[model samples]
Target: MSEIATFAVGSLFPELIDKEADLNDWATEVERTLDLIPSVSRIEIDPPRGFMSFNLGDATEFKDLIQHAIPIGGEIRFHILIPARIQERIKGWSVSAGNSVEEFLVTIDLSTTYPCAFIIPLGEGVLRPSGAVIVVREFLTEELDKLGSKAAIKLTTLGPSPFHAEFHIKEGDVGEILAPGIRVSRAISSGYSRWTLHYDPEVHESAEAARTVIIQRLGYEFSTFYRIVAHRNIHRFGVAAIEAWVEGTLAFYGGKGLKSWIYRTAKLRKILHDISLEILKVQLGIEKVHKQNERLIEKARDRNSKLALEKELAEKAELGFRDELSSYAEMVGVLESRHSNTTQRLTSFAVSLLGVVVGALLTAALRK
Candidate 1:
């Protein structure tokens, strides 16, 4: 039977420690450093959150090196999983270390034959464990070394104290030796064990390819969530919002139950349905407004075209009226000239008759 152990580490960076601390660059450095570890077979990086997951070939060898670093005004936590074969030679073991600022505990299940599982809960935060481990180890090794000494002494002493307990396991009751403050539903079964320490939930793909796809999806979804939330105009929540909530819940609980998963997914689906309806309404309203504007533009063009045609007809009518008045004036001038010639002829005829009468009267007087 193979054993599976899970560990989590957290770190807090001071606001002004490094003004130029780029998360992507920090992730790259962590990836490179973890690659040098002999047991690490694979290293996965979450750049936006500065999170990383390391798959080790033999986790037991580096067990002692799993130490926490303390920094002034900053906190760092480390979580690691080690799978070891159970043998008769070793009896039981527990290790713990803490100060005023930080605390940690590690315990092994002695009663279980093989395939035992353990969990370490780190508090809620956004910084990645890889970057936390690397940066804290480099910057605060002195503080970590002091804590490491206490852990070593505690492991060697093995005294009976509140922090340490011994238990006997019955045939079916594996929960007899559960560590303090650790709660789990079932025992870790014997098989090829897989461990994932990440900040996002991904779609189910092939077992080998799933982690990569999940990390990519997580980054995308996280970014989209922030973008949507920042915009005041967007009132509807969708898949991105749901993903953010689920991710936070999983991170806080450390991925515990099947029932919680079902509830969260169903809730997300219902919200998405409502948001879709809202989007459809917005689209329809926009289309209606566009149609109204188009009709108004067409009406204005038609009115302007009718006005232009009316103006042209009015100018043509004015020209026709002017030409008819000029023709009437020319006909009046010809009639006036003919009437003057007729009056002159009548006056000349009357004068000739008077002249003949006067001549006859003068001739009769001279003969008498």
Candidate 2:
């Protein structure tokens, strides 16, 4: 809380400006100027990350668009912010838009002190966000068209970057962006709600483009953080409460049984308690039922594998046969062949002996 700054026009509710005092150092200046009540505050946690968009059609209408942009809840679209969020880039070379300059110090006045979003058309337009706009061959919107992701695919309808537009919001730097909504840092660095961010000015060497860059960044941050905040706010304040209240109002509206109405109120009370518990679980970062199921699955798998191995060993032991089945079959065939050979040899020997005796007797008769 002691280290952040907020928009100069925001409500007096808990804001980031109380922490910032006077900022001579640009790095600490945004934070220092937090004293400007209602100004945007310091970025709290995580190297910043989120979506960005630019929605000005072209440069010809810069003045009109800038006027519109100053008011809260104004319609802004089709501006380049980060990683291809815009469908079109304001034409850099076209006569309709001014030349896209690279690297310079810029200051567009959207100060709540003046209650205006006027681009300070001074000595030179403040253009540096670290450096002047890097006039690349293609605008972020046009380049993103070539990508296959849904974020890019949806922006194909956006024509081009606006000649007069917001700057890009980035992971670490904060400026040039404003808010009629809430902004939150990444969720990981959750505790101790205070932090600082920095960008290299010397390397960028273009301060004039600061407003456009910061405004673009605000587009990205707002798109990301505000959506989440809105959802949470709605759930916390709208859907959850409305659903509960509707049930109550309907039960009592026009008419109802006295006892039934009492029971309904009691039920509503219990539901609110339960809803609060669920919200608490989410806030506490304990809401992952899927992980709980995965843990159970892992435990079951471990138990099953152990059981399967044990069962296999038990089956092998139950048979308890020492001889291999194929070896025993081969032994049986060999014994049978040896027995057949021995029987054949004995029969042949007996026949041959009988022939010898017959021959001897014939010899004796001839001699006589």
Candidate 1 vs. true structure, TM-score: 0.18
Q: List the residue pairs that clash in candidate 1.
A: 7-79, 7-80, 8-78, 8-79, 9-77, 9-78, 9-79, 10-77, 11-76, 12-75
Candidate 1, residues 1-368: lDDT per residue as tens digits? 11122232221121112224453354354444434433333445333332222222223243322122211111112233222221111122111111011222222221111101111312222122222222223323333234432322112111011111111111121222122222112322342122232221132222223322322222222222222212211211222233344345335333458875445433534443443453344344334434543343334335333221122223222212223223332333343343345345545665776777777788888888
TM-score of each: 0.18, 0.21
Best by lDDT: 2
Question: Residues 1-368, candidate 2, lDDT per residue (tens digit)?
Answer: 12211111001101112224222232232222222312122222111122222232232233211211111222211111222122124332221242222221122222111111211222222222211122221332334344323221111110111212232222334432122121223212222122122233443333334334434433322222222222222223323333344445444432568776445434544444454453344333222323332343344335333221122223222321123322333433443354356456756887998889888999988999
Model 2 misplaced stretches (Cα beyond 4 Å):
1-201, 214-218, 237-368
Q: State the RMSD for candidate 2.
A: 33.1
